[model samples]
Target: MELHVVSHPLVDHKLTVLRDKNTPSATFRELVTEIVMLEAYEATRDILVEDKPIETPVAPMVGKQLAAPRPIIVPILRAGLGMLDGMAKMIPTAEVGFLGMKRDEETLNIITYANRLPDNLSGRHVFLVDPMLATGGTMIDAIHYLAERGAREITCIDILAAPEGLKRLEQEVDPSINFKVVVAAVDDHLNEKAYIVPGLGDAGDRLYGVVD
Candidate 1:
């Protein structure tokens, strides 16, 4: 697994606001969309494209277009839903899918309660979006779920990640599965309660308010 941290003055500026507990849900939602759009630029650098012959107003020319078997964007439910619009706007032609997964606070184990994706994702590129990578259990399980269905290449987009989570991903995931993680920042570590420290707290709560 490869990791890419996007470093930009704009990203840093927005992230600071996102980290503030005082930021309202409306503003937080908007910031999440903006940051994801910026990160999508770097995450899709190697996306498959093919040259297409086209006739310009003055002359015939060749331009590039996304290749066949359009990529699929899968957001890991709840918090992940906050990132869907930004990613969809970046690649309007890409297909969309959903995977509902939640981490058991006590066990840190991932529980997949919903799945709405193609039965066969053979050779199709997948982009998995989630706001945070805390313990990495949810992500690791999500990757395995995709791989089981024949997805070989996947790109994971996250707003923040913890070193412990990233390390867990590296040590636990299959070597054969090709995947990369793109994030705005990598925080210091996961606190005892398994939350990224100095990180934006409970992305879902920030974006949609707390749930009982």
Candidate 2:
């Protein structure tokens, strides 16, 4: 399990606004979107590409294009939905999938209610987008879910993560699984309720203003 804590100035700036408890719902949502887009830049660093040479206005130039079997972007539903547009804006040719995972509040265990990804994902690169990685249950399940379907590579992107969650994932999850995480900031720990301490808080709620 590899981890990347994005240190870009732009990401930090946006994250600062996001961490502010006083940030309103509208502004928080927008900031989260921006931070995800920035993190996606690092998350997709190794995305498959094919080199192509073309004649430019000045001279011949070489470039690369997304390789065949374009990467698939799977946003674990609800909070993950907020990251889709930001990722798509960067990788327009990438295929999009959906995974709806719910965590049992009492047990803090994850349950997959829905998945619409390709059945034969062999040799396909998959990026799982979830705003917060608090306990790692959803992401752990998400990676295994895609791997079960033959995904070649998997990367998890989040705006914030908890150290306890990251460590638990490293120790408990299978080492044979080639996985990496790209996040804006890794917080100190998880509260009793399993929320990242001083985290943006209920990313879905902040984004959509819906309470249950």
Candidate 3:
């Protein structure tokens, strides 16, 4: 349960635009992509790689490439879908997966409505993408599902996180999960209704213009 706050200037710049209520959906979408790319850069610092010998016109040299057992990227849908393009721009060869989840309005519980992932993620480096980690329900359920499939090394990437959510994840989940949470900003608190206070509202709605 390690935490990595991306403090780069470019990340901050992108976040400022994204947090604006006036930013159009088109621009907001692009900014989210850029920010995710920056955060993914940090989250994937320890990605496994192997050396391979290669010959160039100038000289022969050895370089590093992704190790066997290709990495997997799972984005919690619908808002998570907005981040897919950004992530794919970096790891084009990685396998893509999707997990559809929603938070129950009344009980604030996470509900998994759909999942489309390979059977065995064993020995795979998985990156879980979700724009907002306000209450931690969706992320908790997501990690549990991935773990059930044999994914041991996992990283959760988000644009924003609430303190309550981050605390709950650390206290409730085991540290050995090899989980690293990379976010641009950790907000102050969660509202009684489980929404992040002064946080970006309804990531799915903002990203896709859906009310439900």
- For every candidate in turn, the CA RMSD to the true structure comes to 0.8, 1.3, 1.0
Measured by lDDT, the strongest candidate is: 1
TM-scores for every candidate against the unseen true structure = 0.98, 0.95, 0.97
Taking all chains together, the TM-score of candidate 2 against the true structure is 0.95
- State the local distance difference test value for candidate 1: 0.95
Off by over 4 Å in 3: none
lDDT (tens digit, per residue) of candidate 1 on 17-66: 99999999999999999999999999999999999999999999999999
Model 3: ten consecutive residues of lowest lDDT: 171-180
1-212, model 3: which lDDT tens digit per residue?
78999998898888888888898889989998999889888988999999999999999999999997999999998899999999999999899999999888998988899889998999999999999999898898888789879896989999999998998898877655778899989988999888786787877788889763
Highest-TM-score candidate: 1
Question: Once model 1 is optimally superposed onto the true structure by TM-score, how far is the C-alpha of residue 140 displaced, in angstroms?
Answer: 0.2
- What lDDT score belongs to each candidate, Candidate 1 first? 0.95, 0.88, 0.89
Which has the better TM-score: candidate 1, or candidate 2? Answer: 1
TM-score ranking from best candidate downward: 1, 3, 2
Residue-level lDDT of model 2, residues 17-87, one tens digit each, is: 88887999888877877887888889989888999999989999899888988899999988899888888
Clashes (N, CA, C under 3 Å) per candidate: 0, 0, 0
45 Cα displacement, candidate 1 (Å): 0.4
